[model samples]
Target chain A: MKSVEDINEKIREGSVCVVTAEEMKEIVKELGAEKAAEEVDVVTTGTFGAMCSTGVFLNFGHSDPPIRMQRVWLNDVEAYTGIAAVDAYLGATQQSEKAEDYGGAHVIEELLKGEEVELKAISKGTDCYPAKEVRTVITLEDLNFAEMVNPRNAYQRYNAATNSSDRLLRTYMGTLLPNFGNVTFAGCGEISPLNNDPEFRTIGIGTKILLCGGKGYIVGHGTQHCPGYATLMVKGSLKSMDPEFLRAAYMPGYGVTMFVGIGIPIPVLDSKMAEKLAVRDEEIKTKILDFGVQRRDRPVVREVTYAELKSGRIEINGEEVRVSPLSSVYMARKIMEELKRRIERGEFLLTFPVERLTPGKALKPMKTAIKLVKSVMSEAIVISPETSVEIAAKIMIEKGVNHLPVVENGKLVGIVTSWDVAKAVAMGKTGKVGEIMTKRVIVTYPEEAVELAAKKMEENDISALPVVDKSMRVLGIVTSEDLSKLLAR
Target chain B: MFLRLRFDSKAVRKPVISAVTLKTSALINIIKAEVGPRRGELIVEVDDSIAEKVEKAFEELGVEVLRLKEKVERNERCVHCGACISICPVEAIVLQDGRVEFLDKCVLCGNCVKVCPVKALKLPTT
Candidate 1:
């Protein structure tokens, strides 16, 4: 077995042999691990996907009148400025106040691409720094320092996401079609760095890596890292990185996020390392999760290998589902190749981890969620506007439902209650139910807090509210009965 | 070629797709389907050589045939991450030689268009 120092000496002398994670599989299969380890010095692995827990730290040069900024916004996207004067950390997912589809990720990409950005900051004005506000444009070259510090990235494996419910699910995993219609997953499987080194034999703090096409280092075990499942906290010089490797993704229904390109080079110190590098797509498995459930602990439908997922088909609960990749295996392969070329050309070298990554607690979610209209609402029974009062009354009695939303062409037009039917019968009115139905119906969205629905019902003296979407399509019905049941609990 | 067939209640019960495929000797691979007694929608792919023949045969069978030739216009914003590869119901996108390649098998399902984070892909109706 060779050492990292020996591999570094070979790299310096331009005598090192490097292969990408993709090519290592074939070489090891032909030569076997023992021979392949002696032939290759490093194996480059990479992955690219939408990583939300990432951001940048920027040091805007001090202005003429120094100010300790209290608030900061880059292109109308707020940046955290609680650290120091002219310093801020802009998260990748923060949305822009000025517009939709624009966010901190876009701002970061613009800077990396050498474009000027509008910077506005406000301060309370201290004696040492008297300026209360500053507004100006700055490019990447103008910043004192620009470093990308991603707290969590390069997940070892991510569960594939699918939806089993009858409605479209727009999530960070992309759009999951209703009724297990499609599957979207991340991780490049065999070529992914963490998958290659599952036990962190060479990955940990101070491990040199390529971040956005620039040299970077792993800082520590990323937040939420637990046993067997590894992640990374890495930092790189943002100013030196190439914009081609970093991109901002404006996911429809979800906010903006960044596609981070990360490449890790593992020194083939022995046959054991070579065997690990030879792991195939079929060997790496990730769970399939149902994103339809709007809870922290979404139920796992099944386990699938990346090979099965990449084949565009997988069986879920006795049904075959169409599969897709949320992570770009193509881009990940590109990064691996690029890193391999750099290593072979002596421009890049491998480094041993100064400290190994250790297991930690899993991610902790909020203990309680404020009950929403959706939580208590029941399925809505709908009726056409032309239904006769006699039929409406008969239907209410047969169905035992108090309220029925009067719909015309799939839109909520009016609401008819059992009380309306009683009044209609008492008044001996034989006209259509539309005439007696409440036209100015009170409504609440499914996402709205239950308390708001309660207040609306109490103030308006209405016992129920129809839950509708933005386009007035009826979803469900929430009533005093449901709220009272919840309150009793 | 990728095609979407709409069958009215009258035609849905007749097994139109089977008859058309038998007539043209072309196997039809369905991507997604939604059907009831009233109406039905089917997205399918056929061999490029037999695409026009299959379309005509389906239309003759009282099925509304729409040629899904609409393309995904990939701009410079695309990172070629292959996220769109898996989301394409028709498997029109694939990675070849470390690059994302778009094939003629696209059905214009639009899942990739919605899933793209950078909005690099757009399906402009032709």
Candidate 2:
């Protein structure tokens, strides 16, 4: 068994033989694990995915008067400034409160492109800090320090999701094409770090890793990490993993996710680690679930190996379903190749983890109680069905409400939403509210659970629901926006 | 006479095949062709006597004739993801030393444009 010290000595001498997890699999097959273990010094693992938990910590350097930033925004996307005076954490998924699509990821991309990003901050003037507000543009060169630290990333493997219902579902899995038309899976497949290690042998706390294009380390086991299953355990025991057996994926409509560049260097300690790296895609299995079900307990339709999923087809419930990976294999391979180059050139080195992760830790599902929604839902604004469509639209715009319950004679008769008004305007059908408002409205009771209400919204494909009582009196209104706000909190 | 023609998505599918068939009929020589998924550009040589006839033939085939001096264009949509940098066989696109530079070494191979996941690279169409 080779020791970490031995590997470091070889690296220092520039005589250490290294191969990607992909290449090592072939080498191990040709030469048994015992032979391969002695020959290969290091095995590199790579995965690229849109890791939303990622963010950059930036120290903008002190201003002339040194304003302690209370509120910070980069290109309108808010950055957490609760840290120190000028330091802030910009999360990848944090979007501009003003702009629709621009987010922290875009700001980073723009910075990498060598373009200036607008930095706006508001500070409460103090004795030491004088500036009330600062608006300026800064590029990567302007920052004193910029480092990306992600809490959870490089998941070992992921479950594939598909829609079983008749309607289309827009989720983080991308659009699950209606009726299981497509299965979307996001993972690095065989080359994945945890997939190669299986039991987290050589990777832990401080294991050096490739983050983006820079060198980083594994901080901890990622969030939602569920281990302990013999899921990817290979049979007949030849130990060596081929990164090629891993598949790269790309999720449509979800932006590029699981495409975040990640590489982990594995120190070949013995034949056991070599055997783990040799695991192939065919041997790695994942559960496929029906995300169409609104409940947290979504049913697992089938269990398929990564090989079958990567082949672009899997049988789900006896029907053929086309599968597509949301992560890019090309990018993953490129990351692996780049990491290998860095190591061979003596620019990168592997580090031991400061702490190892405990296996079999299950992530508990978050339960959203209905009481949270009731506290957030404001009083419902009622409108007369006789109100003109133009006036109803005006009320919705002025009041900043998307849904307006049309009540007559003290009973909720119909509902008019912003979408209905927009559609009316688009179709040139401006008239009375009664003519355009939806008479058959889907609703929920104040006593109903938030999950049930959210499920109803999903089933009907509506954004807003009028909360009513047993007497059919409008109590309040809950919207998709409110649920989002609840979740955001 | 020399000309450069840009083809749309439909024409890019069977670019050479369609161009060769049209070349036989129009009596124009296809000097070279570079094709990609969304678009492609071609260099053609035609006798000055039949230049107008060849141009008409390409136009009928729904190909846009670009100015001969026009080069590949990068649009505002470019996220500068650097996907094109490594794939460029000519080292035309580069991301080095904190800069993303497009060099003149570009052979217009169109490989960078195809590899761009963002669809930001645009060939000289106008």
Candidate 3:
């Protein structure tokens, strides 16, 4: 395993990122044709199924030519049919004796415009009109070198099956999805309440995510399941999608699609219970088996701005609400609606104002609090400065903790919480904490009154405060526990 | 999709030989187009000396090669466990046991063959 220091060093070195599709294309170009071909292991002949299956083959080194292809086969086809293409490609490979052989009328030079291509007829009618053969142009996507199994059949099936919705769905059915109740989102919205929660350090920015929901939420992460509403949001580059359009495109037969992200979890007896329920029947087998590992105990209901619900900006009967760092789901929804309406109307600032709390003039000093300064504090959650808000949410769930103290130069500078983590997660930031952590942290002097600390806690809605000295070193944490002890005495 | 290859006997070397022993392995030149320069061709020559040893190795590794032809009457032999699944940096494995059972996601660096437990999974012989 890479140590915290090593990971930090890599982060400091910074990464060369391709910011846009144009940039990514340019990088491929820079790699040059021969390198590109060398990098290109397999080509999929343009189908979502083919692309994904070829992706799997490329992933596993099972595909002989080592590259699945797409696009060059598309010709003038505006949109390539994702799944059907995969099936045709599979047919070609399975029946062939030559491992790297490529022969198929399946590669359609003409795109299926209004009708599905008659694959069977095409296969039978071998040679007729020949302009150019449809071949999926091959390109190599860089690898993360991460240990991920070829996704279960269901993963590709469902992701491909869903069409126009902006919200991508990843499910863990049967034993394929691990037994963890953590999910990370990358780059999307800006929600603040998520910024103050305890589980805030683990999320990263702009990275692939694994969401663990269901049983893992309740059991592993100690959270109370409140009846929170969930509203799915789908945003595309163009405003061409609507609820009905999405419904038609994605959720055709299924009443609704439940998408959750998670991580590896500690196995428990409840998983056995889920297994029993799954084995009893076939249809719900996936659900039962999935429940064994899913951490849904902690309910993270999706919430949208109230204005969207009222004005029908985004329609669906789920619920309309706002989520605030301090406000409960009920109040937060109303506030969020009004706030979002203001934002849409250009009445609000894009970012929240930063507030640094300290001792006020009227506050009294502590009886025996001494400001002994220390250079550093142990027992802290160290995260990269660039980790995004969404990834922080995942980190919280995976680490089974809520608070991640942001450190710089081996000294605590800022702090992040579960709420902040969630907000960052929802916003889809995959950057480090330095980018999201509260740069302006509230520090209480040792000479500050207990009442002042109490007020700070209440005003900031924080559970603890780092008592610091003049040198900006953390002396001690004046926590809720300490306050409670004082009250008892 | 989830079957492990095991030998009939516990001997290690014989099973290893039997596992790679294709009924009629393709010639090296044909395989070269696919495997490229880094790796050499694969040819299935019936060497009785290695067959028993191959089977023994497979058995020793606790692999049970699923005999689809004999048991299920299907000629298909390999299942896509992605011996190289965890190792690949780029997410190449797009589909398995689905449409396009194998993908060109491979780097063709011969890592999968090295990791193949049964030695049956390999690049086509040149």
Candidate 4:
């Protein structure tokens, strides 16, 4: 296997052969991985997407009298100053208190673009560094140090988000249309940095790369990074960044986040590296999670490949749903081309990581003991109005369900219970369930609180209530027995 | 040409859109449609050469057909994050070089106007 030093020597000698991950895919497909490995030196992969974990550490060098700044505000957006006297960390997603559509991400982009930022700080006033308050304007050049240390960046892959519920859902994934009308997904899959090096084979601690149009390094594995699902903790000089590759984005209903452009060049040290570079959109898989469930563990509606996702439309439960690419494919491709140019021009060189990356622990969701009606309900058994009482009795016995919602077409028309069927059998009567079903049916919605649903059942002296949607279509049945089993736990 | 057919409360029940395709050779490509019991709207594309004929047919059926672009405005305030693109039903919105481009195929569905984070897309009330 070739060493990184050998690749660097070739880069310096202006003899390196570099291509983008997109081009390398064609190369590997045309002339197998073994042959491609001997020909290509590096495969540059890139992505530009909203990475909320991005932040900047700014050292507004000690104010005239050296006020030990306790709290900091940049463009009216709060920055954490708990670490030091004049240094603060401005997170990308923090919104401005005084301005609309402005955030820490905007402040960072404005600073890099050579624009001035209004900085204000208040201190509790320590004895030695004793100016209690400070207000000043600063540019990128004015800072003693400004380093962007994003705790998480370059996700290997992320699930495409959709909403299965009837109501529109506004999420960090973007606005998901109700009833699976559209799909919104993150970064470019096959050409993304972490996707090409899924195992962190070439990407590790100290590996040099592009960060928002500047040189950056992967410091370690990102928070919540798992083995197959890799993310990076990266850092780079904020002053060296370009605004073109770093942008401020605001998702409606979801606050501000930064669009970070990252390009990592994977040195083809072996045939294994070549094979990884050949990973196609068809081979990359991402879940279609229903964002309608506002929880850490949203339900996975389906597993689809980037091939299907990028095709502009995908089938969700037999309906063709249009997919939107939230991450800029155009920008991602531009970054890949830019990185390739730098490598070919010998301006950039590959570096071996001093330490290998280790997966961070899996995420632990916030502990919420509260439950909804849906959490305690079972799938409702429904029969049409024309069903005979004899068959309804057989269904109740075979399915072990006491209550059934009588449906006409797709709508909930009436309710029938095991008692009605049994009573019909005892009376020696044979007729359709329509004659026995209750016309005025009580119903509960999916999002209704379990306590409220239970109270409705108790007050009405009913064992179960049919769950329906806005259109009165039967969703399921919530039974008092189900609540008893759940609350007993 | 793309045309939007709006059916008021009284016209909502009539099988007008289906009637257009059933009676004519001009097959409609319905890009976006939202029909309810009270009111309904449809955005469809037919042969540009026969666009006038189709619009006339819809009007004859008492449907309000609009060739509207001024109804919604994409102002200078847009951050071009393309969040509006995700919710746009007719694939009318696109992002090019960090700018949101509204294509001619827009049905004026107002979904993008509702979803713009910076309030860049706006629909002027009649």
- Candidate RMSDs in Å, in order, are 7.7, 12.5, 31.1, 8.1
**Interface C-alpha RMSD per candidate, 1 decimal:** 2.2, 11.0, 20.1, 3.3
Show pairs that collide, candidate 1.
Answer: A249-B117, A250-B117, A324-B86, A328-B81
In candidate 4, stretches whose alpha carbon ends up further than 4 angstroms from where it belongs are A359-361, A371-489, B3-47, B50-86, B93-102, B113-126
Each prediction's whole-model lDDT (CA): 0.87, 0.72, 0.28, 0.85
lDDT of 1 by residue, A1-489 (tens): 999999999999999888888889999999999999999989899999889989999999899988788999999999999899989999999999987789999999999999999999999999998999999999999999999999999988888899977678788888788999888888778888998987788998899999999999999988778765678999999977988788988877888999999999998889998999999989888888998766567889898898998787788778887776777777787788889888888888788999888866676777876898998999988999899998988888898889999999999999999999899889998799889999998888898788878988998999999999989999999999999999799
lDDT of 3: 0.28
Of candidate 2 chain A, the 10-residue stretch with the lowest lDDT total is A232-241
Model 3 over residues B1-126: C-alpha lDDT tens digits? 111243333433342333444432312111112223332222222234444444344445555432111111111222222222322222333233221133433333354343322233455432
How are the candidates ranked when ordered by lDDT, highest leading? Answer: 1, 4, 2, 3
Ranking by DockQ: 1, 4, 2, 3
Is 1 or 3 the stronger prediction by DockQ?
1
Please give, for residues A305-350, the per-residue lDDT of candidate 2 as tens digits.
9889767567877886666565556567777787788778777777
Per-residue lDDT for A101-220 in model 4, tens only?
Answer: 689988998999899999889987888888889999999999999999999999888988999876677888888888887898887889988889877777999999998888999999
Question: What docking class should model 2 receive?
Answer: incorrect
How far residue A258's Cα lies from its native spot in candidate 4, in Å, is 1.0
- When only chain A is evaluated, what TM-score does every model earn? 0.82, 0.73, 0.21, 0.79
Predicted complex 4: DockQ = 0.36
Q: Candidate 2, chain A: TM-score?
A: 0.73
Q: For residues A1-489, what per-residue lDDT tens digits would candidate 3 score against the true structure? A: 222233233324442110111122233446643443233211100001111111111111212222222221222212222332222122111211222112111211111012232121111112332222233332222211111111211110111010111222232111111222211111101121211111211211111111111111111111121111111111111111111111000111111111112211110112221121111101110111122212222222233332222121222233221110100122122233433333234332221112211111232444674322122222335555556666677777887666666666657688787777667668886567777677666766666556766777898888767766667665565666667766587
**Against the true structure, whose lDDT is highest?**
1
